[model samples]
Target chain A: MKAATFLAALALGAVSLAAGAAVAADGPTLAAVKQRGHLMCGGDGTRPGISAPDAKGEWGGFDVDFCRVVAAAIFGDPTKVRFIALTTVQRFPSLQSGEIDVLSRSTTHNLTRDAALGFDFSPITMYAHTALMVHKDLGVKAGKELDGASVCVPPGTSIERNIADFWQQNNIKYKPVVIDNQKELNETYLAHRCDVIANFLPGLATIRAYQAAKPEDHVILPDVLLKEPLAITFRQGDAQWKDIVSWSVYATFEAEEKGLTSKNVDAALKSKDPEIQRLLGVTADLGEKLGLPKDFVYQIVKKVGNYEEIWEKNVGKDAPLKLDRGLNKLWRDGGVLYSPPFQ
Target chain B: MVEAEARRLVPRALSLDNETVRAVVLQVATAAAIVAALYLLGTNAAHNMARQGIVSGFGFLSQEAGYDVGESWIAHSARSTYARTLVVGLLNTLYVSAVAIVLATVLGVLVGIARVSPNWLLRKVSAGYVEIFRNTPLLLQIVFWYTVMRQLPPPRRALQPIEGVFLSNRGFTHPVPTWDPAHGWMLAAAAIGIGAAIAYRRAARRHHERTGRRWPVLWPTAALVVGLPALAWLAGGSPIGLDVPRMRAFNFQGGTTHSPELVALLIALVAYIGAFIGEIVRFGIQAVGSGQREAARALGLRDGHALRLVVLPQALRIIVPPLTSQYLNLVKDSSLAVWIGYPDFVSVTNTAINQTGQAVEGIFLMMLVYLSISLSISLFMNWYNRRIGYRR
Candidate 1:
């Protein structure tokens, strides 16, 4: 009876071991990420404002800043990041493979991408509308006027679907000339393979820069075809990672809402307001709860600066991108950037 | 017999006592170690994947693929399931591989023959062709082609003026012939004609073997192949119409267009593989002893006939195996389509893997597809090699 009991106990132990392994396999990716030292971030290599390399080969852009912000929050060093430059096709795979902790590329937050592509998107950062750009001599005023026009667009982009949907819904007939790369899309558009080029508004600015030598030749259509809510993305099934990323973005917004720039963050830390105190790590344990140091938010604001500062230094009017704040400004300033209360 | 054996004490042959027992024990222990290692690896991988919250199963394949594919053979929309998308990708891979193989073979053989041509210009040209194409990296070549193709003028100012064909940076737009319902009968008739031709050839060969007189096999086969098709066309009222491409202000309408990405990938694969095939062909011809060709010439055989009957038959033995490897290489290189966004099997599967988070299943499917393609080519080549092999 003793031997039989021992054998039964061994079998039970083996079964429990197997069950324990299975449970461990389902551990949250957020915890795994923290255990691993640096955050792996993926971004585009071409888009000027979103993510592109500077002359010294360091990445600097609006999306690139967010990556740094996340790194700053987690590791207390903004440079604690390994940037993986990816093409449109490679972005999602790089994220899914756990090759990158987050994808801050100019990816749109859509239903299909969120659910089908197995990615969770943070709140939208930049909301821009897709538009067409044409040569000035063409006299094309609006997308609706170019009903029978042929448009050049990059393949595997939402622009293609949007163009197709627009045509189908309106019973309008137009031809879509799809190319794979930005350079090819630009070339084909320049060579008159199509009447107009379709791309995101920011990308259109890049194209215009190329065509600027002959500036008298081109004009952007005064039509907004589709609204694209670009957001940072990460692999799904990691609620903690999602919260960390979500709140990191929210921290920037909250900082902006409190009129706390990097210069004023030190003074703001001594404020009496409960919300300000909680945000600046003076009277709350938000950072501790997130497995971060008590002064994590302070480091982010001081070192990385607030959302507006990052934007102006990278993609805003002062930067090389020279893009307008547009819908990226604070909610009080008539933009969509609003943060939930820190409390 | 047993009594005799006992009386005659023969030395025990190769006793399985000490050393043999040790050998068996060693082999068993090694196998057990290997099995244990494999078990550990499997367990560890399972544990790691579970810890990462990744499911290890083939169940995700049936889920809806909400992403759109740029190119597909079948009618696939975003609503189609992942399985169907993979099928489309697989078909595209096969399509490119099959077309590339045929083109490469023809070009390679011609250039291979040209390399050994007696004429100085032809030989130099062929050599230069092989060297230029072979030296350049395939990815660079693909990118170059894409760039150059994109620089072509738009459809409105397409360089080619042919009525039904338009060439531009976008791609070659051409009229695809639409077959009416009556065209099915014509296709059936053509198949019958081919069957008849085969029957006639067999009959002709048998007649020649018996009577020592040759029948007009070539003429009859040609008539069956061409004349039957023509007759079918007449009977079906020639139910084929060109759907000509029309130019609008922005793009072309009413015609089939091959995207620049596909064209670039196809060209790069063919160009790169064609060079290797050319070398294979050149070597195969050279492997046939020069003495054989000289002997044929001495026997009053012309250069063409000497090559066709004497050199080629011998050279084929050396040519086929490596040529099969070239075909396999072309199929594998089609994966580079991902770089240019051509949506081949690897590209689509990569996307599916990303979408579903089923890396193991996706990678397994990819490996299996490529493996099957390689195995099929090898099997066919092996059979062909066996049939043509020199027998002692």
Candidate 2:
């Protein structure tokens, strides 16, 4: 009887071990992040305002800041994040294969992506649109005059489809050159292999800033191809992790609306207002229900700053990109960047 | 006494010396294990995908691709289905493979012969060509070719070394024959002429075998093949016209053009695969014994005749097997055309995967297609090998 019982227990253990591995493979990314002690974020390390590495090999960009925000929320240390630079083609696959905890790449959130890719996207981080950039010598003002011209594009993006649709609808014929790497595409375009370069507006701005021989000689056509919402993506089936990320993004907006900045986070910790107190985790431990420390929002603001600060440092008028926060401003400021109540 | 000895012997099924039974058992065990492993992997992937909420099915193939391919041999649009896009990609892959294989074989044979040439300069140059190409990586060669091609002069100053042909950083443009209704009849005449020429050669061969008298049929066959098409075209008033390319505002217009991507991919595939094929050809020719050449020479065969009749016949027997593998490699390597936007099979599937978020299905389709192509190549080569091999 003892021997039979031992055999039964051993068989049961083996079965349970096999089942546990399968569940663990698709289970909570939160536990995996905690166990790994750092967040692995997928992003393009060359897009200046989005994600780029400094001379010291540390990444500091808007997308990189988002990764830091997630890191701060989980570990209370913004430095506990490792950014894995991925190309346009590699971002989704990297997320699906569980190579990264979150994809902070400037990827658009659309119906196809939301429904098809086994991933969930957080609220819109930025509103992006595709545009064409051509040499001043081309003597063309807009996309309409680019008939029979060659255009360079980065592969595995919506830009390729958008350009095709635009040209076809306008009854113009053009050739497309799909270079897999954005940097290489820019080089090829500058080499006159293509007549025009088509990419997202911010991407084109970054490329022009770094790669062009004379940045002023290039003209960004006033034609917009497609508007999309760029968001942080994580694998689906982990609703808890998705909610955590979503709320974390909301916290940034709520903080921005409350006139909170990284420097003022310490002072806000002592606020008397009930809403501000709950948001800073002073009056309520709301983060516990989301499997985080109650000071998650406080850590986020303290480390990565609010959305306004992030925008100013990375892509605002004073930055190298010098981009206006036209549509990315808070909802009250006549922009689309909005968040639900943190309570 | 014999009966008693037989009865004393162990039964074959129980005996270790039963080789047939043991072999069957081992093979069955291995096959079962392989099947079980495959089943487990498939089920695990399905379960994990389901748990992750990833939709897994071929239904996405019918969805619109919504992307433009750089160059396609078939009719394609932004609204084309993924299945149609895959077909276009497959056709493009075939086109590159077919053209590259023919060009590579021709170049390889010349280089191989040059490598063995008695002239010192010819041999050294051939050796250098082989060493430089085969030693460099194919991807680097492709990128280098593309970069060099991209550095050509702009459209306004496109290099027109020859009249009616334009070369620029954009691409190569030259004259193409404008299609006419009469061209269809011309093609049909050419086909019929080829058929008649083949029949004449067979008849001549039979005549020679029967009467031991040589019939000079080469000129007549060539005349029949060339004359029939010319005659048909003339009868149809020579409607064909040359559509020469001309430089327009931003690009060339009205001519057949080879895109920079296609040119780069072709040059890289030919240069890289040609070198490996050259070595194979050289080894094959060298494998034939010197005695055969001596015997042919003693029989009053000239150098060219001896190589054609005595050496190559033997060399080809060794060359075809490895040559088939190289051809398949070229077909597979054409996928690297994606690096330069050539819209080959893997590239299109990648776009489809990205567009539909159907990575598993797209990958599965690619595997099936590639496997079918590889198997077809293998089967054809095996058939050819059996037909040409020395019959014992």
Candidate 3:
């Protein structure tokens, strides 16, 4: 009787192990996300013009829109995205742990991150420059005037190196008050522990928006300090998923180049040009080849609109950010956002 | 022959030999199985991580950190290696922990004594402080302090209290000393004085032990410490000048200022940990039997002497062990400085991890640092406990 029971228990254990192995062998993250019915995208909750939640708790920004675009492409619904707010410190770990499918959290594409960290970056979404923001009453017009000054910057950011390099090249002496969070940096800057606040230009504009009642009190320096190419990041080793996200971003750029927007996508779908028809998913099996639905690009443009439309709605001249699309413009406009040929 | 046969028959009593050997075999097998399972899990992790093209090594430590820490104790630059950055982080951790320990101990001792006061109001207030701070989470307390500090008035409009001190949301600013190159000897003299004072303290203690007479150790030590440094200052003809923070149109210039985040974090850590230390102290005092205090009172000793000479010496035995743990906890809790943006060990390591993408290396360093701190505290406390324990 004991031998029979032992044999039965062993059989049951083998069955359970087989089941576990079967679950582990499930092929792709995209399919898993589709089955789960929500795209988990990591983003910043406080950065302006990037990803931040509104007072009503709705997530909206350039990064937020990109997450929505991915959701629209995958689930055919822009709202099928859950934004996981992460700090600069938490972003990569959260991505590696599969806590978020993509990290659209103002992550810079660098050699160390790409080669060492095992993150596959998408095409550059926004090219930004580091700038100094100071109180206008300081009479400091440029970075040079702020010699021997104290500056506040967030940690784990490239702003520190940029500021250091600038000081070294200019032979100026300055102190840095480094904090890990933007809120703390702003507080220190406003409190005057720092003579100037160093951050991305878009972030400076966001700070100015919150200080709009006293808009004249702050001035953003005209000097562009560091060039930061921000891109969306995904887990490495999944070439199919990487291509899907990368091309989804490229589709937005292609839509802008073709002047096809949420309003004009339907008309573009009926165009005679094969590339336009294929891009709109009215012709060709591009979506199927990319392991997405036939109308994936159509759904993305229709729901989230083109890259320019999304930027304009969230962070452009009409929005509270009032940012200019300088290098974010289409390739036809002599910008760097050049998408590959659809063929 | 009959006697031998009778002894053999006396007890074939449950020959336990086979059963004992079987149990030993079973236990060994179980242990081996557990170890094997763990090994398999580790090997599987290694295999999967390797398959993903991730490098499994600690060579990243020598690479450039390429990041800046906000409040490093050591000089750091982007050119600094990860090892140096970690050193800066460890120094900052030790710096904050040391300061917090000292502050907590002083505050705790006072409050603990106050908790047992004859005055109802004073006792109740101390008890209330203990209950409130000890019950609330440390993280929330840190956040509250940070918020309050941030809400202070701006720097340009700082509330000036004294001639050179400036107070604002930024931090407390005071006159900082700018030492001339000639004044370097004062620092050297002060270091020498400190060394001499240590030797003097040992001699005084030894003398007191040999002869049951106490020496005026305080005055001589103080003179050695202060007088030598003062003489150096005079001999150097005042080689140091005060650079008071001057409020300009925009911000304060010349003087040093700490960020409010650091001030808030420091304050929160001290206040929160101090309350727990206070409880340990009160219990230590109470643990001294009431009879001892009454007996001391019956003697010619004053109230202060009764408490100091009769009670405190005994009370320390009960208090020191728990007090040591509280100090250890304070050191560990200092990692919470990350919340308020005070760049401590964890914060700097987090930056290195993000910058380099070497999660294993970063996490290992973090674990090792925390473990070393914890072990050192435990070892020191254990030794102190043994020294003060009930020795015959």
Q: What is the C-alpha RMSD of each candidate to the true structure, in Å?
A: 6.7, 4.2, 5.5
Give the range where candidate 1 chain A is weakest over 10 consecutive residues by summed lDDT: A1-10
Q: What local lDDT score does residue A185 receive in model 1, on the 0 to 100 scale? A: 61
Error of 1 at A112 (Å): 6.2
Clash totals for all candidate models: 8, 0, 0
Rank the candidate models, highest DockQ first: 2, 3, 1
Give Cα distance to truth, residue A298, candidate 1, Å.
2.6
True contacts kept of each: 0.16, 0.52, 0.38
Cα lDDT tens digits, model 1, B21-57, are 5466556655655565556556865655654455667
What is candidate 1's CA lDDT for residue A205?
75
Task: Flag clash pairs in model 3.
Answer: none
Query: Alpha-carbon error at A109 in model 2, in Å?
Result: 1.1
Q: What is the lDDT of residue B8 in candidate 1?
A: 54
Q: Measured by TM-score, how close is model 1 to the native structure?
A: 0.81
- Indicate the docking level reached by candidate 1: incorrect
Measured with C-alpha atoms, the lDDT of residue A128 in candidate 2 is 85
Q: Model 2 over residues A1-343: C-alpha lDDT tens digits?
A: 3433454565555556556667779658899999989999998998877798999999988899998998999999999999898988888888888899999988888877777788899988889899999988888987898898889987778888889899998899888888777777888899998889998888888877777888888889999999967899998888889988998898899999998899998998888889999999998898998999999999999999999999999988757788878799998999988889877
Displacement of the residue A107 alpha carbon in candidate 1, Å: 3.4
CA deviation > 4 Å runs, candidate 1: A1-38, A74-76, A110-121, A128-168, A171-200, A203-227, A235-243, A266-278, A282-286, A320-326, B1-72, B161-163, B176-186, B203-220, B231-243, B295-304
* Index of the highest-TM-score prediction: 2
TM-score of chain B of each: 0.87, 0.93, 0.83
Per-residue lDDT of model 3, residues B210-232, tens digit only = 99566677798889889998898
How high is the CA lDDT of each candidate model?
A: 0.78, 0.86, 0.81
